[model samples]
Target: MFHSIYIAGAEAHSGKSIIVLGMMEMLKAMTPKVGFFRPVVKQEDGSDPLIHLISNRYQLPFQADELYGCTLETTRKMIGEGKIDEWVKLILAKYRHIQEQCDIVVCAGTDFAGANTGLEVDLNARLANHFGCLYMPVIKGHDRSASDIADSVRMLEDHLATHQHCEILAAFINRVPNNQTDNLKALLEGSPFPFYILPERQALGRTTIGEIARELDLKTIYGTRQSLTHEVASYKVAAMQVQDFLEHLENCSLVITPGDRSDIILGCIAAESSDTYPRIAGIILSGDQEPAPQIQKLLKGVKPMRLPILHSPHDTFTTALKVNNVEGRILPSDERKIAVALGMMESYVDMQQLRGLIASDHAKRVTPLMFEYELIQRAKKQIKHIVLPEGEDERILRAAEILSLRQVVKLSILGEEEKVRSKASHLGLKLRDIQIINPRTSELRKEFAEVYTELRSHKCMTLKAACDIMTDVSYFGTMMVHLGYADGMVSGAINTTQHTIRPAFEIIKTKPNCNLVSSVFFMCLEDKVLVYGDCAVNPNPNAEQLADIAVTSSDTARMFGVEPRTALLSYSSGSSGKGTDVEKVREATKLSQSRRPELKIDGPIQYDAAVDPEVGRSKMPNSAVAGQATVLVFPDLNTGNNTYKAVQRSANAVAVGPVLQGLNKPVNDLSRGCTVADIVNTVVITAIQAQEVKA
Candidate 1:
């Protein structure tokens, strides 16, 4: 039997596309041969937008036309002629054609087009029952109370399960209000089947200037066309005084006015350039006018800005309504919107548990995407508090919002509470649940200083000196981890590596019997994850230190579910060449082998032989790790750091570390030039490491 799932919306504009997009992503990550099929569609409308979107986004090999089983017109005609069974047979045959080449198929249910609500619901239920597919009804929850949403979903579930006898897997409630989310989810959690709630985010529905321009066939008259990607959160008619208009504007406002209004035009430019005013998404020059010659010349004299000035043939009011009503779709090119949708789904939904209930066997290979998902899921299993020392930075605040929303960790950020809060607010991020601790005003300052004074008594540290040192955010955050108030700490987004980890070194120290502290990057290539050691710490090390780093890195790999096959990297493969570096690697390999006999360790191997199976077989035919090394140990810091970076840049690999090993407490450092995603990933890894320490 074919394995498939049907995503059906209970009403029009139910926001089920988010669930479809998320499901497609999960399926693609877990399996290779996943198919997207639409059983019926409007003939006049051609292929569905979602089908086009999935095909383009995922780069599906098949044609979009082949994905459809029947047209809405054909289905209605066949049903009127009492050939419903015949229509079902034809649809089933087409579905089987698609499924024959796939492990699993996901059929998007009928869009509420050209049919009444009851008709669409019946059609969806019939299709699911006929195809033996798992049914997931998506109910619209916009402007509804928690009790109303729950009641609607329950009635639908009963209709599908008790009346239609459909295999209902889950009910997804979309557009839930922020306050009602918890109550709605709690109500659904008591049901036998699973459920997912997507909270309301109207910003995602806002159309960008590019979309509006395309819809109205408008022409760009000034500034860059690239600025058309800005989403118009709200629109305004700029027909008043500059100061009064500025006060009326909100964030991401799309302005519409007569193009000859040079005062308003110049006012918008000044407002956007200055941080004191809201950002205008774009300007629609209505009444078929461009800026006057003098204004255009003046605009050319100033520096170029990312503001689009479009000339609209219609009047101001018409232009405003048309642009405001233009709906935004999750187009293949819109990565920002896609990220937000997927992030929301991942935050609210239990991906792993949902997969267990719905999907069966998938690809066994461990891909980088799958590995990252596993990291987030694993961290969520035992939530641990992790402190971010560089909390004032925008990247740190953005990552905190993601981690907080995902419920991946218990986060406490160290900075001035008001400063962090204001920064988060300016970025339009919500860190309401995240604890912001000001190092100078926190209650733990005295206790932390006392502990530090005792720990640093040999260095002549007094209570006053300790108290002064505790005021540093890094020191305060590290102390939280060391004192067991927080489980771990992640810093260095803005600070130097030394500033971030020095506190950990002085207070947390090393684990038992581990003298050297080194670092490794979980270099996630396209299909596999490899460990590269001593890339961030230990500029140069002797044989013993190198061996300890290797063993410690191996333990870390195994701790994260990667089987450790340690390879000592050098310029030569096996013993074919001899030099100081090769000799050092050979000695380190021997020491590591003796220390951890169970782990597969090979030495003096070139990067090629350590990774490529063919080269490995030619060079070292007898070694277990030569062909399939998951961990590589560098001879010195200079070689390790440059090589990891070169590979990362040239190969487009996601280098997710310099994860420090041999630490008594779990403290990891971020790259100064890391992205928001990097910070989030590092925080997740830190939380997982903290779980090990607590265990």
Candidate 2:
């Protein structure tokens, strides 16, 4: 069964809350634990009314902080920074934490109450797709024609299909008039998606006297609090005589009259007590004029079965006008309305179909977008401090701003304090909370230099030479990671790859079982993330070193949530050509499979045969790893580097790392032309790596 499902709105006020409330009740009936999440709430401070209602009513164990993902302002900032993927990561992190405690989760989309609603629609679709949840859109049909309702549903279906690539489990047209239900059903009969039509109920949409009094700033003069939720069927002005006014009274009618009209008030109260007359909803006394003491005494005497009497300063006409416009909301105190809504949903919606949809299996396909999202989420689970050596670079500063905003990792930047701050200010980037350190003047410089000397003393390095080396930001940043001041280091945005990784080699060195460090780029193509190895480190390796790279690269792929199916890329398909390169690749393939017997690996294969299913079937029909490889180990760095760049440019892919593996600690390098996103991704990867090392 699916672990979660998403409820989205086709438009504002689509009665999505009814579906959510009903689904929660339904799921809770089957499972003892169910979670509710609102990924984007319009309210500041992250409070949502629906969350409070569901959590409290169901006695969900989730705290208030756990129920909301973020506020509108925070969501807008993330979207503006092209960090929606990162935002999704944050949401998923929170959700996974919540899911651990529950059997299923119901994630609701945005309320569409603020600006940029169009953007919010796209965001909801992305969130649903990322969560791999069943998406059900609720369409409001009140005050809309049958044709208009059909058009809206069709348009929403097309948007989700074309833009989001999400399959709708089902949809609902809520609040349609009873007369239009059959027409709307017939119009949607041929839809590829399943849909249901719910007839309008005035009770479901009616505002109570207490609600009106609160909205119009009226004071309740006499009534039991329980009577506040009574539905108002209609409103009438009592300016005429009491006898004539009684003729116009309807069931649940709210009477508006001058406060001094004791006869009209007492007559309505008496009629409510008499079975011959229709029950009145309540009485609204207008113009702030109270009845005489005798009337007050009579009202006090009737306090045992008090009617809801409200007093407003506005005249009867103005009070009636305001009451006509009052719209009701489902408050926590209103259990009767909540029960009505739940009953309506359970009666109209197909619970069996919904349960089947929720139980259906979703194919596990990790798109590149999902892989990137998972990366940030994994990094945030155990946040580690990462130091950026090239802090003065604008890309680095911008990345720092995002990292700080998301709280993905603790950041320390190594540069001259004034220069870094000035450059950040010039670029309109905020780095106020990020740690800025001038390597030469930092308080930890002496300590870091001493540690560096101790680690490199075997090479006959003097203390003075070590101090001089520590003055360089790259060396200082790497030393911070080595000395446990920071968890990892990411640099090379303005420096060469060597300048970044060399300090790590001199101090942190390689892991005990590893001989050399290699690198891989998580080439995020359209559908999947392919790990390209030795792409930034190691120009060439012999058969044994190549096998080691394959093993390490496979571990790296799995570390970032990609299942590793190792493919050794060569110039020729299996046994099709003979050359020194082909021979090396074949030997490396044998060596890798032997070393890591658990890993599925195939080699001496052309790129086309390795990645394309049809080509692999024709070339290497019996290979387990052919055409389904997630980790591609190249024969040399030249092939891997050029191929990744070519594919990145051609396919518009996101190449996340040249993340160094086989290291004792995590230190990563970035390309000189990398964007802020690229830098942020590398830093996050480094943090995850550091977390693994600590583990």
Clashes by residue pair, model 1? none
Query: How many residue pairs of model 2 clash at the backbone?
Result: 0
Instruction: Give the TM-scores of the predictions, in the order they appear.
Output: 0.82, 0.53
Clashes of 1: 0
Estimate every model's Cα lDDT from 0 to 1.
Answer: 0.84, 0.82
Tens digits of lDDT, candidate 1, 228-277:
66778888998889888889888889899998888899888887777778
Backbone collisions counted per model: 0, 0
Supply candidate 2's per-residue lDDT for 273. 75
Query: Which lDDT value does model 1 have at 379?
Result: 94
